[model samples]
Target chain A: MGCVRRSERIVRLTRHLVDHPGTALSLTEMAEHYGVAKSSLSEDLAIIRSVFEQDGNGFLRTQLGANGGILFEVDVSTTREQEIMAEILAQLSDPQRILTGGYMFITDVLSQPQILRNVGKMFAKLFAKEEPDVILTVETKGIPLAVITSEYLNIPYVVARRDHNWSEGPSVSTNYVSSFDRRIQSMSLSRRSIVQGARVLILDDFMKAGGTIKGMIALMEEFSATVVGTGVFMATAEPSEKFISSYRSLVTLAHMDEMSGSVVVEPGNYFTERM
Target chain B: MGCVRRSERIVRLTRHLVDHPGTALSLTEMAEHYGVAKSSLSEDLAIIRSVFEQDGNGFLRTQLGANGGILFEVDVSTTREQEIMAEILAQLSDPQRILTGGYMFITDVLSQPQILRNVGKMFAKLFAKEEPDVILTVETKGIPLAVITSEYLNIPYVVARRDHNWSEGPSVSTNYVSSFDRRIQSMSLSRRSIVQGARVLILDDFMKAGGTIKGMIALMEEFSATVVGTGVFMATAEPSEKFISSYRSLVTLAHMDEMSGSVVVEPGNYFTERM
Candidate 1:
């Protein structure tokens, strides 16, 4: 890189960590790339780590061993997380989001890349502690959220398709009832997508009765994968009892009135799960 | 963000710009955030900008107006881009990816976060010049690619679903013949996802005969949007002529023999589109 000055080195080092979140960068290799000594690189990393802490952007973790290296962990500050949730709550509370069946339309919110990115950061910050090997989500809306969360956590994600494409080779699928329509629908995942005994984190954009999430859990079972944790952008408060007993949501859709064009939202179980 | 020291301020400033690519950061606001003088902040930015140049990671452009400020433009170097494309070629040539009916099973590859991220960088670098207001992709496989590209370009994206979901409120749909099966199938997008007269770029994971891409262009027309460009991950060589005349692809699928598990791939029009 030929970045000699301390401030220059700090900027490059910080950019590397920022680009590859959750992935470890070999300190020895980094030193070589910067044409600096190991001790010098270590000092540079210290400055970068402290900057991360002071800014409350995230935290850095360094491991010592053969396969060990420096890693950047995504951690959203409590105040910033609250702000993100409040923003999402406001978007969801828009009366125009109320649909014909009182179903709150959220496609617009998820379509905005910035909102999707921030939402991913929140989910990643909350579920990263689980150390899931991979993320799993159903197709359609969940794909973007899963992709962003995977980016933040530096983990690979597999999307379970709404149907099995035979051209895709053999697939493992399970039928589940759709709470939104009260009908049976099948979801599928490629047989090679996940290996056996992998720790999995299931994420989705929204949940009502958790039928889709529950279906994903079952699909994970087919691969003999462990469901370490589950996260959702929002869930219905009325589904007090859901198909799945375990999951953390960022916001709760408390009430909706199509005729009056009213929608209500509150902090989800995320409050209880995280602080 | 009370970053006092020069290295510390550089680290935090670089982090914010890295987090928000294509979005301008006002120097006055950044100066206030770091509790530093405007002159000092500008000096710090110069250092950061030079570092970014030295690393060939990207470029920083500063605007001189009210709605203008410093912005990071994602630029993948020629050497790094070649490496990325070569890596993808090797991954795609794996005989195991040859599925039934000579179809390639790339779902597993699109699932990898690192590959997906790099692919996004390449596409963003190629199409960012179009300055498209929003990105468009179809449901299922194309969502992750679009989402990642959206992140790099710092623009919003909308996915057209394979079928209509009334829960999403009113939507616009068009029927197209599926290239894989030659069967008529419909794709849809929420009516409110895009505004009239917006510039759009269409992206997809794979294309054969370009039926779906054609559908997306048609849908854009329905919204009174202009199609600035179209990009695809891979396109089949056998089609020779596709439904869409103007589009770019990263890799060309030369041959796939399911019986012998022999697959071949060539670099796509990305080379011609770039240097």
Candidate 2:
């Protein structure tokens, strides 16, 4: 540790910060790990932090003293966000992605590790202030998004299933109208999935009438939990009046016509409107 | 770029390598990015590679020649694998995790990001030789696992749903028996999810009679996908003759009694059996 090269120390420091996002670490302890002077460690941290900020990757937070420590939270910069938005818009522009119903095929896009990895960090930064204890998303499409977002937020995620499985133990059930056909459908969450009085964030792939999100909100109420926020990958622009309010979407489905099978999409409220 | 310090160069190089895992980049271009001499860049990469190898996180593979560039693949070290396995076994040993049916509750466990991150890399390493073009899994429990594994392998993942959603466009369907209740259940994948003759790796959270995996295998056939390998988080030991073979699990469910409400588990076949 005493004779470690400068480059060696920098690589290890970078890896550690990337891995333990949102966790604060003492600089003195880090210096001891590499047998370096405290001043040298601080200098290294400053260089890493400056690079991250300049690159728009994310910045590091360092505090002074015994209780104070250094922390790094991976972020989605404005440039990065625009890149993701462009990707989503470009993909949505393809008419073939439009499906039989209101559903547009996005499984391919969401399944890409890099896409999800970036989008997850975006959601994490967007909602990091909520400080929720857990994230909740109905199963199938939202699972991967929730998993990655939870990782960035450093929390566990619970998935509600359309049907109850006894193996998951007792569950709390709620019925809601389906956005697809307006049919009444019910979803359930395992009773043990969330603790009472916990803060929760709800996320999903798409929102048409907000029926599913409404149902999840009600389910959260049953557990005496607070719904800090509701997030969606995209939302239909036609349904200006949704079943529930107080939600944010990453992209706006400006138009989609089942009659002519046409679709138009734009960036969501999460993105700044271009002049 | 010319005045970049050694720490700055090292940090940027490390971040770039970690970001573009599995992608080959020319040393000459990388050297130009920093306006550094090729020799200096090589020294930086060697330092990064040594640290990663020493920490057992992963290693960098640098090939000589212009066509043959440098590549990095994030991997789960043997020590990391054992740590993940240990966590799985300890969590599975809890009596309260026992559910009404054969299902020992694992939703909470799988929801953790760090655990899934490591477990995903383990699956990636175990099946890297298969070089699957895509990873496939049924809905609900397996989505997160599939998503993580797909990322580690730098491949896409396709999920089969329990029911057909028309908005996803036309989909091919197949019926198979589920292990949960030995009930005949059906699943479907979007017609566009996978291409014909693609090498596929099937993954899941748990397997008992191996019925669900079998169903997935059948579903893959309809897609004209090649089943390269099957991987599960846990498998029941008593199912001496499973619905299918040729699968590797991360842990072994030595015993679970619904009537007695007891649960016992051990490390899976992937680990060397203790004498």
Candidate 3:
């Protein structure tokens, strides 16, 4: 404990903060682990915090006192957010990504670990102030985004399935009109997935007519849960009349030409107009 | 570039290495970023590497040369693996988790970022040497596991859907026998999901008769891809005759009592036998 190298303590501190996001750790525990006094540990955390905040990666909040510790909050700087959105827009602009319908193939982008982590950080930051008890999204495309966001938020995520499997036990199902085809479709959530009266945040990969989001909100109501906020990676500019009154999107598909196979995307409300 | 503190360089090095895993960065670049000479940067990396390796969280591999620098490789130590498996086993042992079909409720655990990250690192390490170009899994349960594994391996993941959506554009579908119900089920993958002759690593949350994994392998064949390795979080001890013989699991359900609603699980091959 007496001879711990300065570099060694810094690496351990950074790794600990990275691994356990949103958790407040007491200086006493950290000091003991690093084999340093509380005063020296505070200095090390100060340097790490300054570097993290200056770089726009995240911030370390320290609460002074015997019980007060530190918490790591991940945030995306305006510049980083723009860079990420631009990269996503560029990726989604490929003509080959266009499918039979107006849908673009975003599975590749969603599947990339680095891209998913970055986007997740962006969304987590946007909703950082919200005390969401649980993250909710309907299967299956939104699963990754929701899971990653839940990770950063230090919360559990519940996925509503398009079809109910008996293995999920008793579940509550709700029918909502599919905005895409104006057809009625139902989504179900396991009864145990969420507790009643819990605050829920809805996360999805895309928002077309917002039908799925609406259905999810309804499903949440079945659990008597509160719908705190909703977020989507992309939303079609058309059908501006969304099912939900309010939500957030990272990018808006301003235009899509199936005949010519072209896509025009712009940053969503998260960037274009911040709250 | 000068006057960089040891703690400062260590923190940056850890953050950068964590962000970009499985990629080699040049020592020159690292030296420049840390504002220190190559020798000092090397010393910092050595300290970071030792702490990481000793802790069994992950390791940093250094390669000499202009092109080669350091690569972050994540691996769970034997003791850590046992602790994690034990914890999961306890959670899975919940009586209420027993589903109508002998399946245990694992959605909550899989969606938890901490649990998924740990399990993912284990799977990633088991297949670390495989050189997989992509990770594959069928929706919707396996999406989180696949995504996390892809994150650790630093590769893209492609999810095969139970039904083909026109929005996916051109896709290849195949019929495979479901081992559970002995029913024929069809799964499809977007043509763009994987490139021909690409090496693929399959990941799943649970393995029964291995029908889903087998179906994924067939789907890969349709795309002219190679199945390098397959990993699952849990597998049934019974059904000795699997669709595929070679695979790895983190835990195995040695026994389950549907009547009594009890389950017994043991650590998977990942811990029982050395590779």
> Scored by CA lDDT, what does every candidate get?
0.87, 0.83, 0.84
Clashing pairs in 1: none
For candidate 2, list the clashing residue pairs, or say none. none
Superposed model 3: Cα runs more than 4 Å off:
A1-4, A63-68, B1-4, B63-68
* Winner of 2 and 3 under TM-score: 3
Ten-residue region with minimum lDDT total, candidate 3 chain B: B1-10
- The positional error of residue B130 in candidate 3, measured at the CA in angstroms, is 1.0
Better of 1 and 3 by DockQ: 1
Q: Write the per-residue lDDT of candidate 3 for residues B40-117, one digit (tens) a residue.
A: 888778888998998887889876666687989987888888888888888887777778777777778787777887
Highest DockQ scorer: 1
lDDT of 1 by residue, A1-275 (tens): 33337677788778988998987889888788878799988888898888788667889998678868998988788888888888878888889888886777887787777788888998888888888999999987888889999999988998888978775788899989889888999999888889999999999988999998989999998999999999998898986999997889888899888777778899989888653
Error of 1 at A248 (Å): 0.3
Candidate 1: segments with Cα more than 4 A from true spot: A1-4, B1-4
Fnat values, one per model, are 0.92, 0.79, 0.77
Error of 3 at B151 (Å): 0.9
- Of the pair 1 and 3, which is ahead by lDDT? 1
Q: What are the per-model C-alpha RMSD values against the true structure? A: 2.1, 3.0, 2.2
Higher-scoring candidate on lDDT, 2 or 3 = 3
